[model samples]
Target: MSSKEKLNDAFSTISDSFLTECARPLKKTVFQKRICRLLPLVAVLVSIAILLPIAVFRHKSDLIPGRWTLISHADETVRKEMLVESAHKPTVSMSMNYNKLPAEQAEAVGFSPEKDPCVELFAQWFYSQITYDYRMHFSLFQKEAVDYSFTSEAIERGFTFESALDKLDTVTSHFYNGIKYDLFYSLVSCKDLTAELENTQGQFYKSIVRCGADPAKISMIVEYTFDDIKLIMNERFLNTSPDGERFNFMFYCYDGHWYIFETEMENDFSIDVLGKDEDWLSILIVPQECYGRVVAVGRGYLLLDNGEYFMTLDELDLKVGDYVHVSFTGFQTKGRFIADDGSTEQKVTCNNLLTVKLAEPSTPSEEERSNE
Candidate 1:
């Protein structure tokens, strides 16, 4: 074959597109090289942008267990306006369907959880405590007191007031958001209770909770059970204040009466200058175990032969004569009672009883021996 005949054969084998300059490899620019290198990163960013919100939207609700409707303030934001606070704060509300609750618990919560008498009582208790409106729930329970020292401290904190009422805006805003939610878990949470109870209860007794008079028991009129109590407040109410970020006022049912048994409050600064995180919470004390003889048992009170009195939440079929071993969250609050003779007695309230076991019989106390 001649050279011309061989070239014609090769050209016939190759396509016309490949034979053109358009199919030839060209030198890439620096910008094109950078873009090529960034392709994978750009793809990853696009994926994240599309997926992150969907993941959030599909996230489950973590509100308290059970079906509940707000009966008090209609909405959290509306509730804030009613408080003594002066600042305009927008509250974020969460609606929940309580899952994993025991059947009995679900029934106890009822169709309208807010209708629980304790919830109403708690609402009144919180309002009176927050507004210092003793006139609100007159005769229902003993009124909550403010430390007069707060007045002097407010000045020390560089706050001034025309009247006592005028001071709450700055004072409350710095210390609290004036919003709260209630939850009832049959088993008490010892985690936060034991940690803060001692210091705050001590301060409370020193300044306020010391009482010689029996607190008037307010009847709910409705047969609502007051157990498994939690009042989740907006964060950063000072950890030690009487009306703090959580469980502003807690009550226990004893002798068919609702009595204020525990309280946690915000720090005095009413200012975030304390350098705590936005979601900062109270410290938790280590739990403990105790073995004792049940000298007395009532609806809300548990007393041991050893003179320890506990306001406990337990599912045990406890009787007055039983000897048992108990695992509990540590003590935090002490109810101080004054006697007519001017002597003072203190009683510590312990809760979050994780477990109770019937232990081998221990020796009887001298008091128990005498009572027998």
Candidate 2:
């Protein structure tokens, strides 16, 4: 299918999943499709805003009979405030016409195959929030990108910056039906671009973010800058080899758009690609007072430190002493099931498929192997 079609399909999936998930008891409030009902009011306001500009220009047509200047000089007295306003709301005044562009064109812009896998993933994840469902859907992941548009509106409504920040905290706990990737964003630089665009020039903000699937580990750092909606990502990949070296990835792009059409990430560690190139591992840490039957391999729950257990989605050939690695897709909480004897058990369900070697046996040490 076409790129736009694919993007629509991906959003359709997210929308459908949102509906399906929202119907569930506790999932309803997490991310409801409430925007549909509110969109009419927004549309009316936008229509009026658009019309007001046209009406003003039409009345002033006599004054500007020939040509209009695209860029105007900033008054020195207000230049600092103007710069702040420009940086605060950087999205180009003109809406990007991605629909008219070919799918390849959209893919070519800004996106590169050689880019750092982590950077691409971050870009996609960050862009996904901006595109599908607006900033509200950002709660699905560890909050990273700041919605200046929303912030601007909030400030205009007379809220203090600190209050606005607190008000934007929508996600109370990280529990949602979406990809389980965590992103921690740190603002690196916000400055005026020295090398300007032909028709457009404004302040650009650079953010250095540590993003990856594993909440415990920072896999890679992505340096990305955005001037309005145009995003450029400097991708870097973390080599899983013994050296743990990192390398710059150069993905060819068209006009430097770099936005991913779909949310399916290339570096999402949870999506298991079956082969020797696997980067995920699973191990069974047997509890000291464990007294359970070997009914199934990975068909069990992992006991959390807080006296809670996380159940496995698929069965693993996990023996007590086995240190097996497995790709973890996601999980479901309060996931309950009825046993054969009619007993219901509630637990955190893990979602993953057994791909590589079934429970690799704990091998003897190198010294032991040499002696043998």
Candidate 3:
């Protein structure tokens, strides 16, 4: 037989066998008839069960766009009102001395005028030192924590002004609450470029921050020209080593638009990285009374209220009746040390001294001793 005829025969045989078995059961009267009647109902219930979840999901999905639109409109209204209020406030402008080096003092600091032409040479030196130190302490690119990765070289090669602007558009569309908003304003507010050229090494663009309440809070928008960017890039490359000592540059490109190239600096000085103060006397102290009435046993340590003095726990040098300040950390209480145990080997009582004064005096009502 031909292949098609063989397949047809196989299907016919299976159907005939199934029908014969079904007929045999139907021959058993009421039982067969009841199953035959319930089969159609069971099929219908199974179809509905499969389709129910899909129908519900489709219904909810249809409502999402409308819900998002309402939320967005509400947010825009609040932001508009805040911007208007912020604009009416008086703005204060203070020149931040970016270059803190004195021109006359450059000779004493071994700064050769030819090598370091900038007058603020000392400030530059300090800035470079701090920046390098911070980078060394903290690796700029934490690869383990990052979701996306790129290098400064890749950013430089891939990026163009047009591309960056396009990426900025995409960024603003998605991340309107962050840097995108700031960049959008910066581009829109780029006014006259009549400022006299100071440095030929880089091109500079500045925009006035119009949306902030305080001038100090307002950011001065500046974009370093390509040459400036290249200089910074070259310096970074030379400073960074191949042994993972360098920072990774991450760039976001949207619709062929490239955003700013940012590398995690080794030392992010903008954060607090200072160590704890070791000198006890120089530490600022507060007294226990400053904190709410001490319900349980509490201890305070010696603190230096004055900026100059240093305090130590050495019993050999410090004695009872010596004037000193004690500060307890959590309680926010600072007091003068009045008395101490003469022996250095034992635990001393600093709380009972007369010289100790509460940084914040308790209200007289709370100060009254309760007659128990």
lDDT of 3 by residue, 193-227 (tens): 12212322212211111111122321222211100
> For candidate 1, lDDT tens digit of each residue in 223-246?
222222222222111111122112
What lDDT is reached at residue 287 by model 1? 46
Tens digits of per-residue lDDT, candidate 2, 314-341, equal 3444554344444333322222222334
Ranking by TM-score: 1, 2, 3
- Candidates in order have lDDT scores of 0.35, 0.26, 0.22
The better candidate by TM-score, 2 or 3, is 2
Q: CA shift at 69, candidate 1, in angstroms?
A: 3.0
**In model 1, what lDDT does residue 21 have?**
55
Residue 171 miss distance in model 1 (angstroms): 4.6
> What TM-score does candidate 2 get on C-alpha atoms?
0.19
After aligning candidate 2 to the native by TM-score, how far in Å is the CA of 114 from where it should be?
A: 7.3
Residue 324, model 1: Cα distance from true site in angstroms = 64
